[model samples]
Target: MSTNKDTMPTALLLGATGAVGKALLKDVLQNGKYAQVVTIGRREATVDEGIPQDKLVQKVVDFENLNAHREAFRGVNDVFCCLGTTRADAGSAENFKRIDQGYVLESAKIIAEENPAPEGEQLSPVHFLYCSSANANKNALFLYPQSKGETEEGIRQTGFQRVSIFRPGFLEIETARSKPRWAEGLALSIFPPVNRFFNLHMSVPVTDVAKAMLTVAQKKENAAKGEEETTLTGSKAAVFSAKIIDELAARPLTQSSDEVLVVRNPYPEPRSFKVKTTAPKQYCVRPNAGRIEPNSKVEVHVILQPFKEEPPADFKCKDKFLVQTAIIKPEYESLSISEMWARVESEEKESIRQQKIKCVFQVPPEQIHHETKSEQSTLDNNNVVVNDVLSETPTATPVPVPLSPVPQRQQQQPAKQDLNDQLVRELNHAQDKITQLQKQLLVKNEQLERDENGFRARSQANGPSRKLPPTVQPQDAVHHHLAALETQRVTEGYPPQVVLIVAALVFVVTYLFF
Candidate 1:
C-alpha cells in the first residue's frame, strides 16, 4: 500500500522499556511516518540521543491507576501494547496476571472506549496491537502462557475494531540484564538450527517481533484505506505466528539505484517468477518473466522514464507494482475427490502458491528545501529569544571570565595547591587503611587472648597432675609467652616512633594549608 506522506499518524507505546518495546519505540520514531509517539511507562522512556524530542511524548504512569490517565489514550491512531512480564519478575502468579492480563485488557478497553473512530468509519482511530506468547492457552498448565492466553481473550472481548496479536516464541533479547538463566541460554543456543524443522516457532529475535508488529499495523491501516488487502489472513482479530512474523520482518531486496529493484528466491528449488507494473510507461523491467535457480537471485533492472517533458509545480508521481513467484508440485492429485473438483482444487492451490510482493516508488517535488530553511529560521529566532532572557537575568556574584593564560608564578601556586590536596587525600586514605588494619589486629589479639585464657582455665581445672603436653618443649613454651606479650603490647597502642612520624606529617599538612 502507498503511504500518504503528507499525513503523519500518531502512535501510543506501552511497555516502551522492555526489549521488544524499546525496539518498537526506535522504529516508530525513526520511520518518519508518525508525527508523534506517546510512550506510557512506569518511568520516563529511555530514548536514544539526538532523536527529535519534538515528536516524542513521554508519560510516567502507574498501571494500577490507569483510569486517572485515561486521557493518554485519546486521539491515538495506533496503540502498540508490549506490556508483559515473567512470573518470576512479578514475584507471584497473581501479580503476573495483574500486569500481563489485567493491565493489558484494561488499557485495551480504555483505548477502545476513549479513542473510537467516527461513526460509519471502516476502521477505528485506535488499532490495538499486542505482543502475545506462542502456544498460549487458557487451559495450559504453565502460568505464563495461560496468563497471556487469558489476556488475548480479554483484548478480543474489548470490541476493538482492529486488533492484531503477535505470538512469538522465545525471544533472543539483545539488551537483557546481566543475570543469566541457564535454561534460557541453553534454549537460545539450541533452538535456531532446529526451529524450521519444528515449524519455525521455537525462537525469534526481539527486533523481529518489533518490526513485525509495526509492519502489520501499517499494512492493516493501508488495507482499511482500500489501498490493498492485508497480507495477514484472519477475522476481525488477526493473529501472526512466528514464521509469519519472521517473513514480515524481512526487508524486500532493493537495488542501490532507485530505478532498479532486486528479488531473490531463498528456497532451495527453482521457481518461476513474474513482474507487473501499474505504470508501464514510467517503469520497464527486463527479464520480467523468468525462472530463478535454487538459492539464486533475479535482478529485475527497472528503467524509470521521465513522466512529462515539463512537469507542473504540484506534480506528485507515484507508482505501485507487483512481483510474483510460484513453485508447482505435480504430486497433489492423489487426494480423494471428483476429477472436476480435483482440478479446481489443484488450480486454487497453484494460484495461492504464487507469492506476490508489492512495491511503491514516489517522486515528490523539490519544495522541501525551502521548508527546511524556514524551519531553521524559526529555530534561530527561538534561540535568540532564549539568549535575550538569559542576558536580562541578574547574578548576585560576578561570573569569572576566562583569560588567555596565567603567569608562570600564578600557575606554580595552583600546582603547589594541587600537590597539597593530593597529599591530603593520600594521607586520609593511608590513615583509613591503617585504622582498618588496626581493627583487624585488635580482633585477632582478642581471639588469641580468649584461647590462652581457655587453655589456662582447663589446666587449672585439672590441677597440678595436668602438665604441659610431652610435645610442648621448654623453648616452645617460652616462644608462646613472648608472642602473647607482644600481642598485648601492640593492642595497647601505636609505637612511639610511628606516633612521631604521623605527628610530623600532620604538622606539615597544617603548615601547608595555613
Candidate 2:
C-alpha cells in the first residue's frame, strides 16, 4: 500500500545501528516514502561507517535508565525495533537482558503510555517492527533464543496493538565493512541454490528481508489502519510444501521434459536434414574494449531471437543479467541470467554469428565523485551557500575542469564518507601493483640495457612515450588497450575468447600430427 504523498508514515527505528537495521535504513531511504525518520541507539553513531551524518538522530543513552529520555517517544509511529545484545557484547547474561529484553520492553512501555501528539493532531498508532531468530520458541532453554522469545512475547502484550515480526532463518549475506566468518556465509549461499533438494534449511537475501519489512510497514500504515499483517513470505520452496514435496519425491526425472523428433521438415528434398541440437543453443558477450571504467558507458544493444515458427516456452530468451564488479575492479559488466546477451542468437539456429544487439552501460572514473565534493565544499568557502528558495550554492568551484572536456572527479567513493580515507587505501593498492610490475619489468629492462643503454633510458625517462610491448608492436597503446579490451569484453558474461583459445590449442596439436 502506497502511503499518501503529503503524509508519509514517520518511523522510529530503534536498534538503528545494527546490520539488519542499517540494511532496512538503506531500503527505507531508497524507497523515499517515509515522511520522517528518527534512528536511536545505545550511543551516538560515528562516521566510522560511511553513513552521512545528516540522516540519523544519533544518540547515546543508557537504555537501562531511559527515564530521562522517556518523553522522546511521544509522537513516534511505526517503531522498527532491531535492538539486541549478544552475550559477549553485553559481558554478562544480566547485562545482555538489560539491553535486549529490558531495553526493548522499556521502549515499548514508553511507546504505549507516552502518546505525544499535539492537540487535535492524532499520531498514527505505533506498529512495532521486530527482528527475531528462527526456532525462537517460548519453551526453548537456550539463553539467546529464550530471551528473544521473551522479547517477542513482551511486544505482543504491549498495548501497541499492531506488531510485525521478521524471523529471518539465517541472515545470508555479509557487509562490505566486515569480514564475516566464511563458513556461515558459505552455507547461506550454497544451500539456497538447490532448495528443491534441501528441505531442512533455507535463507533469504538481506535485500529481500529489507524489502519485506518495507512492504509490511507500508501495509500497516496505509491499509485498514488497524490491520495486523501476519502473512509470512520468504524462502518457501514450491517443492517444500507437503503436497508438492510428496508429489516430487514419488515422481521420476522423466516428468520434467519430453523429447520428440521435432519433425524432420516436410519442405526439403535436399537428401539430408540435419537439425541443430535444441539444447538452448549458445551465448556470447563481446565487450567493446579492455575495461569499462567510469565516465564512459559501453553501448550494448540486444539481438532479437529468430522469427522462425514461434519457439517453445523453454526456448524463449529474455534480456536479464546483472552488472558484476570484476574481481579486480568494480566496473559494471552486463550479464544475462539466461547466460549471455547471445543466448538466443543465431548460433543456436545453425546460423553463423549474424546477430548483433546494442545497449549502453556507463563507467566513470573515481575522480568525478572526488571533484563534486570539492565543488560543494568550495561553495561553502566561497559562500555559495544561499538562503531564499532552493538555498545558496557555494560560489567557488574548488576543483578545476579541463577545457577538452572530461568528467570532473574520476574516482569511486569508498562507502566511507571522507574522500581522504579511501584515497590512501586505493592509492596504496595502486602503488603496490605498480611496484610489483615495475620490479619485474626492471629486471628484463636491465638485461636489455646492458645490451643497449641509451635507447631504453630515453624511453623510461619519457614515461608514456615508452615503446609498446613486442606482442603489440604495430598498434599504438590506445589501440592496443582497445583490442585487448574487446577480446575480453564479455569475458564477464560469455565464452567467445575462451572457446577460441581452446580451439587454437587443439588446432596446434592437430597440425603437429599432420
Candidate 3:
C-alpha cells in the first residue's frame, strides 16, 4: 500500500513484548496510516515472520532510566501504552506498582518532556492510548486495580493533550503465553456464550482491544486536523469501557466524517450550554446539552451519518452549528440540562448567549492541485463574464455593500430600581414631616402673637410703671426652635439634600400659608 508521507502520523508504542502490545504492533505496521512505529522495551521485540519491518523501529532501553533514551519519544504524534502486570505475576505488590504505575508514568513524562515545540511556537498535545483494566479505582481494596487506577490518574497528570483509557473486562488472548492464567482462560471460555445469551460485554478479543486503541487514536488525530469527527467524549481524558471498545472496533476505518467541537466557559460563573447542528437528519451531536463549570470546557461530538455515494471533489459543507450558552444561577445549577434550558428560556431568555460556527470540509491533499487549477479556470471565466456585462453597461459600476455590524447583547441595567424606589419613599415621608412641622410653627406663631399683643396692651395701660421682665422676642424664639429641629432631623441620618429640601419647604409654607 502506498501511503502519503506528508499526511501519515508516527506512533510510539510501549510494552511491545506483551500480548496486547504484539497485536497492536501488527495492526499499526500494516495500517498504512502511520509513517513510523517505534517500540521501546527492556529488550528488542520479536516480529512475526512474513510481517514487514521497514517502518518498525525497536529500541532496547531500561524502563527505570527512560531519561537516557528520550530520543525514542521525539517527533511522535501518538503513544500507545499497553504496559501492566498482575500482582501475582509480578511476585509482590511493590513490584506490581513499580512496573505498572511507576514505569508507565515515567514513560509518559519522558514523552511529554522530550517532544517540546521549537521556541516561539506551539504544538498540540500528544494523544495517549492506555490499556487499563475494568473496575479500576484508585481507592480499590485490591492492589492490582488500585495500581491500575492510580497509574491512570498519574498519566492524566503527565499533561498529554488527549488521553484514552481502555478498560476491557476480560481479554481473550489468542496467542500462547509463557505463563498461562487459569482464571483468565476459564473466564474467556465462559464469557462468549454467557455474553451472547445475556447481551453482556464481559470479554473482548485481544485483537479487538488493539484495534479499538488504533481506531480512537486515528479518530483523535483526524478530528484535530478537521478531517473526521471524534468518537470519544466525557473529558479530554476519556475512558472507554469494554462495550465501548467493542463498538469502536466494529467501526470501519475509512471514510469517517466525524468532528469534535469544543465549548469553553471562560467566565468565573458556571454556564449552561446546548448544541444544535443545521443538518439534524445528516448529523448527530453527542451531549447536545449540558452544564459546564467555571473555567472548564466540554467537547461535543458530531457524527455524520453514512452516505450512499461519495460526493464530488468540489463538495463544500453547507452545514452550520450553533452553540447556546447562558450563565447559570445557583438555583438553575441543580436543574437538569433540559430543565435548566427550559427555565432559562421562560425566565431569562435575553441572558442566553449564542455563537454560530460554519462547518468546513477538507479535501484530500492529492486533489488539491487539481482543485486549484479548476478554481483558477472558474475565476478566469467569471472575469470574462464580468467584463462582458460591464461593457454592455459602460457607465454603471458595482457598488460595494457594507456589512452590518453584529448587534451585541446589551448589558443588564444596573440594579438601582429598588434603591430609587426607596429614595422616593423617603422623600415623600420627609415632605409629610415638613408639612407637619409647618403646621406646628404656625400654631406657635399664633400663640406668640397673641401674647405680644396682650403685653403691649398691658404696658400701655400701666403707663410704663410696670417693669418689663427680661423680654424674649417671639421671632428669635421661633427661629431658634426651627434651627434645633433642623439639627435633630439632620442627626437622624437624613441626607443633607433631604434636610435642605425639608427646610426649604417649611420656609416656603411659613411664607405663603402663614
The prediction achieving the highest lDDT against the true structure is 3
Score each candidate by Cα lDDT. Answer: 0.58, 0.47, 0.62
User: Each candidate's TM vs. the true structure?
Assistant: 0.45, 0.41, 0.45
Candidate 1's C-alpha runs over 4 A off are 1-6, 120-124, 196-199, 221-514
lDDT of 2: 0.47
Where is model 2 poorest over a 10-residue stretch in terms of lDDT?
Answer: 239-248
**Global local distance difference test of model 3:** 0.62
Worst 10 residues of 1 by lDDT: 376-385
2 or 3: which has the higher lDDT? Answer: 3
TM-score of 1: 0.45
Local accuracy of candidate 3 as per-residue lDDT tens digits, 98-152: 9999999988888878876445545335788888887677878988788888887
Rate residue 447 of model 1 by lDDT: 79
Q: Which ranges of candidate 3 are over 4 A from the true structure?
A: 1-6, 117-124, 221-514
1-514: candidate 1 lDDT, tens digit per residue: 8767458678999999888898899988887788789999898878888766678999998899999999988888888999988877888988889888888888888888787667887445567788887767676799988888788768766766666677777777776555677788888778776653432335777777776677656644122331111111111111122111001100111212223333444345544556667778666768666655654555556555543233322333344544433442344334322342345445743232222233322112133333442100000000000101100000011112222332443455787799999999999999999999999999989977786676666656667554654444578665367435533233568888999999999999999997
